[model samples]
Target chain A: MRMSKIVRFSADVLFGAILIFGFYIILHGHLTPGGGFQGGAVVATGAALVIVAYSYEEVLHMIKKAGLMLQESAGLVMFAGVALIALGLGTTFFFNYLANSGLLFGMSVPFGPNPGELNTGGVLPLMNIAVGIEVWGGLAIVILYMLSGISKAEEA
Target chain B: MIETIIHVLVIAGLVVSAILVFHFRDLLAAALASALFSFLISLEFYILQAPDVAISQAAIGAGLTTAIFILAIRSTKRYEEDIP
Candidate 1:
């Protein structure tokens, strides 16, 4: 459907709000109920809004399918690579070795309110971020591919 | 509890929306409603403490997926024929 000015403006505003909100959820994931996946999905919703309010062609121009595919693949590779790194470090898969110490950026950040809480850890945060990026990119790409295919069919 | 009530309501909403999606004659409305249904389901997943699944659902199920479905339907001759 073609977007009118009012609809486009509304969608743009909503998309921006969701994008910011998603980042908030991702950054404070440890201290909140939200996390990487939730935040990433929220961001994807923002992209979806752009597509819906504008057009698939516009969205595709902004975020090409090839670039989105690369992003998604990179995110998956990062997650798998991290797991492999943990294995090489003599830990089980998905172990958070980096999170074991409280040092981030050479400064000691307290793990949490409690000294050794499970909630406070090494690789969990990083994993969450990776998962978020992966989900967002992967889903957006899937949507883009579907829309593009439909458009192609229409032309044919 | 309030959480329990919310969960029930969300599930009910999902079921109702799903039925509407299948039964509705208007393709766009049905798709939009289905998207809302998926969004509620995602919210339910969040309440259940599965952010990962919720994220995927919200992104894939509610977001791009629905738009793609609608666009596909639009490209078909169905919407055009119904406009007159």
Candidate 2:
């Protein structure tokens, strides 16, 4: 894949910028417009840009296939585990266990006079993080598989 | 009022990008445009107060998916040919 100098530099810069921006989104997801999954995908896009500019072989070497699969599965299991923990605590699935307990970092922190306030305790933020990881990892795996398959086909 | 205007602009950008994705003869360009569409949709999700969905869509739909499509198409050598 021969790319012009301008194209190569542009793609590299765009890819790097998106990756950084995605992390920013993930970290501040609870307080901002971006979250884990969105940011993670942005990170993956940066990886993809490298693949497009260079070669799939090089990209694969950088991001191993096995590691991606493990990360994806781990994310799914972690999410399910959290749901099960909620059930075990005598609540329905995905109940805000921490919120109901009035606990923050194991200390009794009360909600500010109102139950549904934005600052009130809840597991929604945690769920958001879990889902973000799951989506990012799963999508990365899917893309990696597709790219690897294409590369194999080319080799044959 | 400002929020509404921003929302409208984002939606307009999305629509324009979608149109470009379909109309462009270049597959790579179309894929890139589609990524832009995904980003806009993510922003829409943010507006709708569903950051989780927005994040998922942005990551999976725009980032990784676009790269996969581009690489797969590149390997196939069909991107160079015009679509009928």
Candidate 1 lDDT tens digits, A27-123: 6676566787778777887877777666667776788888878888888888898789989999898876776465641223454564333345466
Model 1: what TM-score? 0.76
Docking level of model 2: medium
Off by over 4 Å in 2: A1-20, A34-36, A100-122, B1-19, B36-58, B78-84
TM-score leader: 1
lDDT of 2 by residue, A1-156 (tens): 434678678877887687777667765665566666667677766766666676666667778878877777777788788778899989899876876455541224444653233343356556555666766666667776776677778779
List the candidate 1 regions with Cα displacement exceeding 4 Å.
Answer: A105-120, B1-16, B40-59, B77-84
For all the predictions, what are the DockQ values? 0.50, 0.59
Give the CAPRI class of candidate 1: medium
